[model samples]
Target: MAMMPRMELRQGQSLVMTPQLLQAIKLLQLSHLELQNFVEGELERNPLLERDDAADVPPHANGGDGPLAADADSFARAESLNSQDGMETRLGTALDNVFQGEQPTVARLDTHGADSLPVIGGAYGGSGGSFEEGPEGFESSLTAEASLHDHLGAQLDLAITDLAERIIGQHLIDAVDDSGYLGEPVGEIAERLGITSARVERVLAVIQGFDPSGVAARDVCECLSIQLRDRNRFDPAMQALVSNLHLVAKRDFAALKRICGVDDEDIADMVAEIRRLDPKPGRAFGGSTAETVVPDVFIRAAPDGSWLVDLNPDTLPRVLINQTYHARVSRAARNDVEKAFIAECLQTANWLTRSLEQRARTILKVASEIVRQQDGFFAHGVEHLRPLNLKTVADAIGMHESTVSRVTSNKYLTCSRGVFEMKYFFSAAIAATGYGEAHSAEAVRFRIKQMIDDEKPAEVLSDDAIVSKLKDGGIDIARRTVAKYRESLRIPSSMERRREKVAMAAGGR
Candidate 1:
């Protein structure tokens, strides 16, 4: 064969990820808040993309100029028709598009002859006319509240005269967790600070007496005892009950009565007093705001006994290509740069709209498939949550496993049972008891939790016992598997449970 350059004609299909396609994929996985931020940025950069405000067109309609003809001079005139200020005014409407499920109205034009600016609605209390409605002091009050550490440090600095005691007190305060219990032992603190245990104890005792009655206690016993003493109820019975908190926790009233040398009535009163005290004093001081969980898909029971899967309108991004603006800009575009800009904007706007729609459809498809496959779970409970994986959903939906994974990732589905992460439906399979369908590990775990929760304190269920119970229920799981599941659920072993029960029983006395 001659090795020479030759011209050949061939055609082959290839997959290329364009920027718009990449954007679509990126948008698919973004949370609602993130998508809002992204859309806001796009609105700022693209002038042609304007939010669709559902207000009738102005009666005069841009100086009664019906429409511009497709001509160079008409385009030149159109260029002047939409000034930079007017374009900016249009872009301001982009803020309105950031929120979904709301009709975006035109921003009222400024009375001083400036173009109307669109303002974000009820987002961060920004000065957006009616959108500026929120609890005026709610956010400020939260921010102004003193934290646990601040509260303790202020009292320490004000009350403590000795510098050494104050220093030790500060270290001890730092050791106290948000739950008001000292994570580190007093002996360990003394070792770490080269101070005597007595000195650390002294400083701790003082810190415990801060504004919150149980601010720096070593354990629940100390926390409750401090509160009892503050209320002048630290009697022999109360002292005995406080010392044996473990028994109190397990509701061992008889044992608590014995330990406290009090009758049933006296023990009950002491227990009630202890119950009234705040175990976690630090919690009284506000902490970080809880992160809200928003579902991506909602599945409800249809009238026909079928599961209806729908995308959460709140999370779904609503966007559209402004054909009106695109036409205006296209006819007015003069130079190559201007024409290219207009064309690119039109393409991006169209692609974004299509991508959002596609994203919604794909999500709905995957979710619908999930609900179909795990229909029993929705109808019954987690016990019926079959052993599912991405491959199973992908096969059912006729999509690739990766696509299913992408759709499910960072996505949550809410149904009659509860809000659950999409991944929660999938679980490793457990071997069936010699026949029938394979068992779901999640169901087995739930079963184990139920068994433990229902077990009597005296008859605390061991892992082996759990394994036996599971076998009786037709789940062929081993002792180690039960142990692993129990650990995963953070359930203490049988011996620990027994001790806790015994302690509670003793404390009640």
Candidate 2:
């Protein structure tokens, strides 16, 4: 080896993730809400970017002169071509080919046409109305209801008069959780407040008598006892039943009857009464409002007996670059700094608009492929859902599996059956017994549920029986797999189901 300095030329290639490419990837995965917020932030930052609120102008209206007008024309032409062609024809190449390392093709979005934009009818089976109206009509006008804390605070204010007792009551109320159970023990509260346990107990007693029946109990047993006492039904038998809730959970009627010292009819009555008690009293108040899920794509049946997939225009963020303003700003730039800033803004704005357009198109392309692959599910039911995976969709659409995964995340599809997350269509395949098509785990689960639902009380199907039935139907599944699916469906073991059915039969008589 010689210690010398020499110069040699080398050639190599590497994949670089530019800022704009990263932004495009981020935008593709964002849910509709997140994308809107991101676009709004960009609009505020970039003077050249503006909301595309103007009425739809034909590409020829301005003689297709400026870059903006040219982009509009290209988008319009692309949309027209897409509408005329079938999905299979339009998705001949991967979206990555059109955008990555190539000139991006902007897809036109028709805000008015039913054939292009999502409507409320076909797949949704909704009456004639706009699907984009959202929850603004009556829900927007309604006032917020009182929370559990507020409700309890108001009751504490009126119920407690003595300053010392009121202070203790307030501390106890603060300790109560959303489930209406007192989170802190009386001794801990007393120690924390530097008071006696007796004082805390006294205050807890007074607070428990407040409205909502069981606002300040320490445990489920105490909560049920408080409610039963209020109803003047907390007798010795009911007390015994409440104390031994484990027996009730197991549906051990014999043990419950022996422990409660009541006959079958009496024990049943007491158990029914216990069931009527509110387990979580505070849940009825002070909860966060439920958010409505807005679907990203709409699928409807076409007149030609095929699925018509369309992107929800409402979810699409409509934005555009103001070329006229950019031109004016560029002409008036006083220095290179201002000129560079303006140029950067223009580039960023152009990228965002193109990215949004591409994001919408990518979603539409992937969703169309899913609808095509799961056509049986749409036409029939969950029982017909074919086994699918991210790789299968990615390969079919000529995209990376990671890209397909991101598109399906936080995205939903609406169809005749109902609104479902895009990921819901994907399931592991259960092998077929012979030379037949593999069954989707979801479809197999549905079949199991159906079988159980139709089984007579005398003929309750165990996991083994269910497995045998599935094998008969060409689904080669294991007993453990069936058991796992049954558990996922919230179904109990065969013995528990049999016990429940027998109890129900006796109760019916």
Candidate 3:
């Protein structure tokens, strides 16, 4: 059929993404630090917004004065709106209406639990040095320490007099890595620099004699031998032991003892001495401190025998609306442009205040539901964490799945068990045989970890053995599933655990 163009009218409704609505959605997903930065930016741009410092005032004189009180009023409005039949729907509608005629203004805004090996303490006066009281109070070593390259460069400049040799020495030093081992071979470096391999080796040997003692060695054996020679301990037996370092790493104490030609007592003493040597000599030079996580919500047990969910007051950014200033600006506005500016600021300020309050409430709500569903987890431990999903929480709280997901993303809740990501409560179901309830995958992982943690070195549990134990506990998980969970918890394989245990046992000897 041929169609002709004609004028027609149709009526329909759709959800529009207003700026305020988008802001609210964005606010819900931000972590505590991120939300703090966003609110600080808003406070800088909007003259009507200020932080509510009333909570900080002493009780006797806690009464707030001036426009800061508007925050409480905004909170009241939020509560009243929240009490409506369809609170979220009504809240969105009100925000949309307020920002309806607002023209967008250009605002210039300037923008892992890893099971790490225990960091061995650095050598004397290295990264792990203790602070001493200076002429002032205790002085901190905040300044970045000299890098490996810088340290070697200084030594090269002082020790080498010839310009050409100094250049080669610098190139050789550049080849050294943070672990104090040469990344490139001396011959390769010589070829690249159009120099003799013997000259490069001579310079590298000198550089290895620097303060770190093993900074320019090409391999672990050479690195350890350099340190040992410097300390007058690199005897023939020590040389043989250094050459067969891999056997030492595998904890083959018998093999090591034979190769070093030492009895059990002497080899044990040698092994203990080797443990004191720095494997990554340059690592002590420059490293940053780890960033710590601050939990967003705090869950404590109430006197009524239930979980009490509250926003961490320390993390929650206190904000207020300067109504007195806003009213004054509105009265003094001389033209449409000025009035619009004031109106936009007021709306933005009010929306942000309400949105912040709503963000807190949503976090509390989601945390409460989580605590309710996994109340056993809070009461007991991780083993009792039930199988949970976003849809289950959304259904219980009468919210969308995506909203629940946002509330849990990048947010953490702290309880008696310790701080955990909100996502920690949501785990896939692990099937159970017979008439028993399914187990949370997380709980299963924790159980697997517990088994591994308790396993004696002599009787380290293999994946198959772990599967049998889990089945005995009523969790119908496969051997592969046990292996997967074990890896996820950063637990090494049974073979690796056995090696580690062997090493510990040998060290004790």
Q: Best-fitting candidate, measured by lDDT? A: 2
Q: Rank the candidates by TM-score, best first.
A: 2, 3, 1
After superposition, which runs of candidate 1 have C-alpha atoms over 4 Å from their true positions? 1-14, 52-280, 505-509
- Pick by lDDT: 1 or 2, better one: 2
lDDT of 1: 0.70
Candidate 2, residues 1-509, lDDT tens digits: the string is 98999999999986667767777777778987777678677777989887764222111122323211212234345445556662220121234474453221111222222133343222211122333555465557778888776687788879875545555677788778888989989997677666689988998998899878888899999999999999999999999999999888879999999988889889888989999999999888866556689899877776656666766766776777788998898999999999999888887877777677678767877887787788788888998899999999988867889989999999998988989999999999999998999999999999999999999999999999999999999999999999999999999888888888998998899
- Ordered by lDDT, highest first, the candidates read 2, 3, 1
User: Using alpha carbons, what is the TM-score of model 3?
Assistant: 0.66
What tens digits encode model 3's per-residue C-alpha lDDT throughout 289-350? 45578787767775545555656665667777778888888899999999998888887887
All candidates' TM-scores? 0.61, 0.75, 0.66
CA lDDT, every model vs. true structure? 0.70, 0.77, 0.74
Q: Candidate 3, after superposition: displacement of residue 122 in Å?
A: 48
User: Looking at candidate 2, what is the lDDT of residue 509?
Assistant: 95
| 2 against 3, candidate with superior lDDT | 2
TM-score of predicted model 1? 0.61
**Model 1: lDDT of residue 38:** 70
